[model samples]
Target chain A: EVKLLQSTDVTGGTFTLLLIGMIGTAVLLFLGTGWVSRKWKLPVALAGIVAMLAAAYYWQAREVWLTAGQMPVIYRYIDWLITVPIQVLALYFFIGTVARPPTGLFWRLLVVAIVMILARYMGEVGFMHPTLGFLIGIVGWLYILGEVYFGKLGEINTKSASETVQTGFFWLRLVVTIGWAIYPLCYFIGSFAGGVDEGTLSIVYNLADFINQILFGLIILYAAAKESATAR
Target chain B: EVKLLQSTDVTGGTFTLLLIGMIGTAVLLFLGTGWVSRKWKLPVALAGIVAMLAAAYYWQAREVWLTAGQMPVIYRYIDWLITVPIQVLALYFFIGTVARPPTGLFWRLLVVAIVMILARYMGEVGFMHPTLGFLIGIVGWLYILGEVYFGKLGEINTKSASETVQTGFFWLRLVVTIGWAIYPLCYFIGSFAGGVDEGTLSIVYNLADFINQILFGLIILYAAAKESATAR
Candidate 1:
């Protein structure tokens, strides 16, 4: 049997931190929608929805971590499976205001994002060779980065007249780049390093998500509010 | 070691049913908000929010039920802990439109509702004696019934002038009385009786929630839509 690290005060504290951050951010995004212009409302609200879903998943995660004294891998993946696509789509909605996205851009990004998550999940669960899954997952993430930063969407975003939109797109893209990179790094260390325990990985994962998920939405909200103020 | 029922096709299918019901209802309630008037919008949308939260919880519950083949009682209570209060508040919001609810009515009902869920939860988890917990839970439920049925809120309902609100109040109270009874019945069977398996109790609980959660919201939506159409 694989040995699991029992929960310590630190891990439990981290989970609580995650829980509060997600719920607080979710409520903020939802309430913040009223302050933004109509066009920005959907993206902001979608982020709120994603945060709400994450908050619910973490509710169970915190309970399991504290009570069962082990991480349930399924909770993390299930959370990503639902929330990640919505986060990606929040970006789609954010840009739809300033630029007409190319045909198939939405579907392509969604499919790739799902594949990225599925690849990592299959690897973690031993359904595929870990190295192969990691490679496929990385490829999927890189494709997304290319699409948002250098591909057709990126071209549209560059050509768009709205400075607010352009600035927001830059930060959102950077988050998907640098902020999301934590996932693969965690995967590598947790699965391949053979030294770190689950508790450490859990805390690291929680912190990464707390930053990425909330920061992604905050960038959009900032742009939306700025745009709204200028328009008014 | 406690024996766990191996997941079968039937149990798996039931979980899928629960998952689909929750998500579908959540989406429906959310989208249905546009059809209601501004006064009724919060309560209708609050129901949607509740359904959304329920969908997230069921997603996790179904995963554990299908894979672990055992009920995680904590998932049920965690779901209730958050969703139940919002649901109670939904009723409070609904009645606020038609009647000036008495002072302390909201807090009293909310506290009793929390007490009800906590008592049963503690009983299930062995934090307290099961019979004593069961009795406290029953007492809490009865107090809520009294508050809504014959206490100040119910008295206001009887004196209300709006036919739609009065009719809606009648059905909503029935749900609280008859629909919510499923919990105590399930708790009694699962805890006190020695015969029923966890699988059986899970199926019962899922079905009960699928009905209670959706039906509670639908009744509000129906009344709100009717009132909106008539007023317009």
Candidate 2:
């Protein structure tokens, strides 16, 4: 008899967690936007849209995983391709709340973010040599880190007068540097390490995504809420 | 070899339609709430929440059906038990904009809507005799129709001065009367028809829900927008 999942199933359990993470975060971010002033609402609502987009993908991914008993790699990448870029762009908008960053910074970060996700996707799906794809993806990520931490974006953050914006920038940069490390680490292990199964990789990916997407958005929301409070 | 679904699959196609219906409706309703006056925002948001709630359940149902190749009966019922009652309660609040529905009317409609869903659920799952369960379910639905159409709620609608509300009331009542008939019709056929396949029944039900939930909300949103426009 075919069954969607048993209560004790491990992978199914992780899928449930991601589903909850996406939906819960979306609701909180949407509701949270209402409390903040108009200037900060866009960033907070952008965070919410990220969660909602991920939630839709997770629905399809859950179906794919449960029925096929296989990793839903394509769905995950499709989600990342759209959401990750928006997330990168969200940093641009988040900074805009305090002072306008150069418009060039916006397009630069967008391009880099898309390249990062695309390179990794190509590697995972065999469009390029895995090592080449991995290396390109790493370069794209490091470029973002440099741009946000030590490049023009970083310079703007240091000059911003709002302590709330400064604090938000510090944490956002840290997330890009540290929280994002899990993706490459998992990719290296899955591609280069011998004998790692798909199920383990899938679960780890789900957990990483839960941290990556939801936590990233929550940080933006916290900053927005704080900025709004201080202004009043 | 198990597969989630092929591109040309009919049941899978219907599932896709329902997924799109729920998510699309939720987004539209949420966005539409912004253009409306503050007084009408609550009702619009409620409609969005109904769609959002159904979207979550549809994710599970899609997984269950794709994996198990079964009807996903329980998921659908669980969804109905929550959302159908909320839709009924939404009517109470919708009418509240032009006139306060009797508090008793709210409680009565809620109770009856729940009974209608639960009775059908019990019969479908074999927890009660099919014929008796169907009869009770029909009675519950008919009672709701009478109350909304010819009883105290109907009385309030007729007395309301707003043309927008009157038109909305007409469409909303028509949905309850006509749009909702598919559920019992499907139930009766599934229980009594000797040769109906589960796949056909599932597709039909999905289409009905697309009508019942999304169309029902759209009618309300249209009226609310109209009311807002007229007031301005």
Tens-place lDDT per residue, model 1, A1-232, is 3334345578878887888888898788877777887567768877776777677667767777766677755556656765787788788878887866865988888888888887776776677887998999999999988888888778889999999899999899888888899988988887778768888888888888876787887888889889989989
Per-residue lDDT tens digits of candidate 2, residues A1-232? 4456777678877887788889999999988878887667667776787788788777767766777777645556656766787788788888777677888888888898988877776666566777888898899999888888887778888888888789888888888887789888887787678657888888888877777788889989998898889889
How accurate locally, in lDDT, is each candidate? 0.78, 0.80
Chain A TM-scores in order: 0.92, 0.93
What lDDT score is found at residue B218 in candidate 2?
Answer: 80
DockQ of 1: 0.04
For DockQ, the strongest prediction is: 2
Q: Provide the clashing-pair count of each candidate structure.
A: 0, 0
Tell me the DockQ of each model, to 2 decimals: 0.04, 0.07
Docking class of 2: incorrect
Candidate 1's residue-wise lDDT over B8-110, tens digit each?
Answer: 2445445655564566457546745765678888888888888888878877777787677776667889889878888888888888877668668888878
